[model samples]
Target: MCHIASGWLYGGICRSKLRRHYSLPEAPCSDSLIHCCCRACALTQEYTELKIRGVDPSIGWKANVEKWNREGLEPPIVAPGMAR
Candidate 1:
């Protein structure tokens, strides 16, 4: 998703296109443009968010769903649906 968004920022580095038609500036695009510049930090932020929410991203989504069902807990896979 971040990669898709970088185009408007004229970003093509990191998770972006890696191709060029116009010159890209050597500055940050937007406050949320982490993936186009700092991928590690972006990943860390996601990991931290999951940890803070008590959701282990290392576990596959399906496994989490199964575990939630077994434990009678609500699953964390609700956002991807709700975002739509």
Candidate 2:
């Protein structure tokens, strides 16, 4: 049940990026099916890709946010009326 939901979410995310950023016409349907059977491998690939792109996932979100603040990086924008 979790795999089904997660696969759908990630597949939508990957497909959106592939089409908009990479100019890809189609993402394979088999990718979602594969994710159902092999979620760990799918997430491993995602982690590896993030690492290759110079982002460290191990430090996690809150720590990374603090680090970015200390480094004087721009904070992410919040939508109007949204709490920080």
Candidate 3:
């Protein structure tokens, strides 16, 4: 149940990233439809896209952000601060 519910969000996010990476004006189909039809393929494509773009998705997002910061690139999103 949790997987099904979260699928919608991840599917849309993957599709959005693909569109942004390719500067696409519109997608060939909706994210949910594509994911529903072949989720593995969609995930593979997203993973490949990340690998080709030099992001190691095996590493967590915060680590990736720290890496980008070390490289002198501003992170796309800011990390939240921890309160004591």
Highest lDDT among the candidates is held by which one? 3
- Tens-digit per-residue lDDT, 5-60, candidate 1: 65535432432331111222334454237655676675675567566555777896
At residue 1, candidate 2 shows an lDDT of 83
lDDT of each: 0.52, 0.58, 0.71
What overall lDDT, based on C-alpha atoms, would model 2 receive against the true structure?
0.58
Model 1 weakest 10-residue run by lDDT: 17-26
Report the Cα lDDT for residue 37, model 2.
67
> TM-scores for all candidates?
0.51, 0.46, 0.62
Instruction: Give the clashing pairs for model 3.
Output: none
Model 1 lDDT vs. the true structure?
0.52
* Ten contiguous residues with the weakest lDDT in model 2: 75-84
Could you give candidate 3's per-residue lDDT for residues 1-84 as a string of tens digits? 988668866887778776665554445787767787888887887788667666788996679979998999864432233346
Residue pairs in collision within model 2: none
- Candidate ordering by TM-score (highest first): 3, 1, 2
Better of 1 and 2 by lDDT: 2
Best model number under TM-score = 3
What are the RMSD figures for all models against the true structure? Answer: 11.6, 9.4, 10.1
> Which ranges in model 1 have alpha carbons more than 4 Å from their true place?
1-32, 76-84
